[model samples]
Target chain A: MTLIETILSVGFVAQALRVTVPYALAALGGTLAERAGVVSLALEGMLLFGAFTATLGSALGGPALGALCGIVGGLLVAAVYELIVVRWRADQVVCAIAINLLVLGLTRTLLVLVWGSASSSPRVPGLGSTGTWAFVAAAAVLALALSELVRRTPWGLRLRAAGERPDALASLGVDVERVRWGAVLASGALAGLGGAWLALDVGGFSDAMSSGRGYIALAAVVSGKWRPLGATAACLLFGVAGALELNLQAEATSLPRELVQMLPYVVTLIAVSSVARGARAPSALGQPLG
Target chain B: MSWDRGDSGASASSSHGGAWTALYVTLVALLVALLAASLLVIAFDESPARVFALVVAHTLGEPYGAGQALFRATTLVFTGLSVALAHRAGLFNVGAEGQLVAGSFACAALGAALPAGTPAVLALPAVLLAAAAAGGAVGAIPGVLRARFGAHEVITTIMLNFVVSGAVLFVARTWLFAPETIHTRAVVPGATIPALGLGGSAVSWAAVLALACALGVTWLLTRSRFGFELRAVGQNPDAARAGGVNVGRMTVIAMAAAGALAGLAGSGTVLGYKHYFEKGLGADAGFTGIAVALLARGNPLAVLPAALLFALLAEGGLAAGARVPREIVDVMLAVIVIVLAVAAAETRRVRASAGDGA
Candidate 1:
């Protein structure tokens, strides 16, 4: 019950980071895509694909090359996603869900075919143990800068305008589609790195390694009001909840561990509901610019 | 993601034929995909002819396989009904898995604590009722939040699924099932529904019960005043409200009803098959229910056939000697679902554009 004890508890910090890393990265990706006016729901699918590809890449090559492969893989998926939503003008929500299903199966099937194992954990040069927390910090900083750039820079302003009102932006001579494409690809890369973090840092490439964190990240982005710093903080909060659950279980707390585990999700629900009315998403976020 | 400003207006003035046509195109697209998938299977050394034959053979192979499929379909039918019903009200109940799990947990508790001398007939219904109530309550949470607070049901529903599963796993492991067994205790014989004797495979009377429930729901959806309100709300909430429908209440009630149906499905699994609530019993029934609703085009009557189709594919895929990697079925299903969703969205877009043109 002591404040010092609570802060020092291994469960608190570990659970917080364990939950925060993937979510923070994914939400950052979501912030980028949404900021550019595209609803990048493919974040979840991309996350899974990232995990699968990174593991596969590391297994075949090494960690660095594998991470590169994951980036490529993710961008490739984003391109396909762009084709569907951008070219065909498909409903982004459905397209994103389909993409999730597609990646989920494709990765699992491909893994089976190639690695002959559903759970593919590759031995590769991961971020050294000492650098684990460093990676998380760097990710948070990068996301903050990227989000700030999207808001402050001329390029960021144009991208925001393209998402807000395409006719106005197009009249200004900006190709809305091109801007969205770049944003989406960037989104994929960030989401892919998030996946890489999961594979390399979180237990190596289990089938359900992402475990719906992609969706959770989406919630984080929404709950964070689609701001980089807000989303990161939200991710950290959920991470703390998750890490706390583990430690609570370790301490053999009388409160059911399951209920404790439910905290993050419950928090997400409460946060989303509370903020939904006040949150101002980009006006034209899901609206495809002509 | 490109957002299409598909006229989501609630007007029957737009040609209804467009919706039908969209459905038609979707069906054709699905059939084409199936044909292509079948050919792919054939290319893998199994004759296309033999594949269909085996599907038929394994599905209707014996009284047992057929019975099992029917039983499986019964559970799916209710879950599918859960999804379809909610869709009619424009609420996506993706947490059917959670609702179902929660219902099963409640049902197990109800069955275990029932008085020793209770009659089988009364006991069964009582257990089911308890399940429905519990599941319905859980379903109502998101419904209430969405109605009252405008919370996105998608996020809440997905999160709820995890919450339910995690909670159920812990409770089942620690409290309900003796830790020794690691699952809930068996339902008392009086609480169990007797299965129809089909050689080898046991078909629960629950199948007939589920079929009846499906018919009743279909009737309620198509013939009742509530159905009209539900459709109006789903098709256009703003319009429904202007027309005097309490859209919020309708959403909440619809979710509760859908949850009840899903709860019944979960109870069927426990009361008829396992007689105990086990971890992972609901599996992906909740999510699969979405595909079922879509495949059935949100028709309560059609959910039966769609559920049966999925059950057949699932059972057939796993049957020894099928020669197909079961995941292929998942791929086929996914393809069908995406294509259908696209077709639906496209039809909506085309009509909207035409209206805008006018």
Candidate 2:
């Protein structure tokens, strides 16, 4: 087949959509948390927890139940993060880093205990093709809803206020802490869902399976300037790059596989640098709330 | 911006009653982390107290175990110092992993390529210096970007990590690939740092090098003119710039210094232990350095003890792997960091309030 024809194949499009789903969801989640003035570096940890729990739950119950379990797992970690970061006002970046490490270790240990392996879990029932499509649809809806929530809704205004001017929100009798807590929890849930998609698509969990997608999502957050739709577009751009890599690999092209594998990250680095000047973060990003 | 209002105050008061408070907070956090870790042990049907006793005995009680712990601490000290130095200069060096990779690769390449019969003294220092230079070059990429473009160091550093990892893999496969093996060729004997005779353990003189580096960093930060400017930039870049301390130059220098330290960590692991460039070697040491630095609260001297504590956990984790999953130690480390961060925040809040009252 010609190169153009190969690139335009339906299989490539499906694969690109699948790759885009996790990045889009996670980036949106990061946007939510950061928009509320909290750094969400724990997206990586949350993704792992979600993937592990989803796999376990699918093995025990069903795919739907597994997804729910994923959210719960993420919430558990988020609760600890909120306690440390929000209540005690710890360094957000430090707490996020700790959470990532904790989740990585915790999940690996749990995998060994439950599945008798430290690297991966047994294959479980996954979301079938139809269910996968449903998930994609759900993600799209989530992006739209989140954009509206951040831009139009009263809650969105309050959330932005919490991030931008917490003191002002506090003086007006709105609990900035509570708003931030909600945003953080919501971010965890979304990141967990992203992770669930990863496991459910593969029907199992692998060590560091999320790899650096969480960081990529963070990059998308920056490149998209912390807007939901913009972040989604950035994720799709990354997804296209990922799809192109797969196509190149399949075509047995002369380009080295390692270089192809590096495409998405290299693109992200370049995009982030170029856009760094224009991407303004929340006013209180990384700040401990008083 | 208001969040940092508490930092200056806390730093000022820390001089008076700060040491004790910091120690107390660290102790409490360590206890809390241990307790939380014990709960996980209980879930595994293991007695936490017994497991703790075994871990302590296996890691610190025996000579060989002590040597192993010290060996691990040797590497942690370098990476920890890398993070601490950067932190003092108001830069978070999250790319230590990449820097370490570059350094080790350079060390392995130089050590292998050198004339086989070179003198130990000449070969050793040459390999180490090359490693540091390579690491510093890699680190300066993000530093220059941040200084010139106002890009966030955290994001740039993280992105560079992937870039470095990929670049290293590509280079290894194309140029340095050892026939039939994933790792590069082993280093010459003259280049390898001889292991100190410590109960026949793998512990080497590299531990002394780590100590010397720690002392050097302590002296640099405390007594040097550059150190003062770096700290000034960290505390307040605008004020430092106004006071004629070239903030941009200091940022680049601090990041290079941080990278060089991490590079030493990588080379120390390769020349002092592995003797070759292997994929995934010393991969997580950079992240562990973050834990070490946080526990040390950016104090170069304090990094020694913090590194030792973490090294103990690492050694204990391996010893206890039969009865418990080794990752539990990681969970404990994370828990300790979280607790410490919270405690540190509280201390800052109290100090800030006191300053307000005054």
lDDT of 1 by residue, A23-77 (tens): 8878887887887788877898888888778777777766766667667767777
Interface RMSD of each: 3.6, 2.6
lDDT of 1 by residue, B1-358 (tens): 1112123232222224545764576568668657855765664566766666776787787777898788778889989999878877877777788889889889988898888788988998899898899889888888988888777777788888888888888877777886678678887789987888776565688898889988999889779999898878887788889999999999899889888888888766788878888878868677667778777767778788889878886667656234645555655666666776666556657766887999
Against the true structure, what is each candidate's TM-score?
0.89, 0.96
DockQ (Cα-based) for each candidate: 0.49, 0.64
Clashing pairs in model 2, backbone N/Cα/C closer than 3 A: none
Tell me the lDDT of model 1 at A146.
Answer: 79
Task: Supply the DockQ value of model 2.
Answer: 0.64
Specify the CAPRI tier of model 2. medium
- Stretches of candidate 1 exceeding 4 Å from the true structure: A1-18, A119-125, A130-134, A166-175, A253-255, A284-290, B1-56, B320-325, B352-358
Model 1, chain B only, scores a TM-score of: 0.86
lDDT of 2 by residue, A1-290 (tens): 87688768898788888889988888898999999999877888888888888898889998998898888877887888898899889888778878998989988888888988989998999999998998889889999999999999999999898889988999999989999999999988988888888899999999988888888888898889999999998998899888888888888668777888888888888877888887898998778787
Model 1 deviation from the true structure expressed as Cα RMSD, one decimal place: 3.6
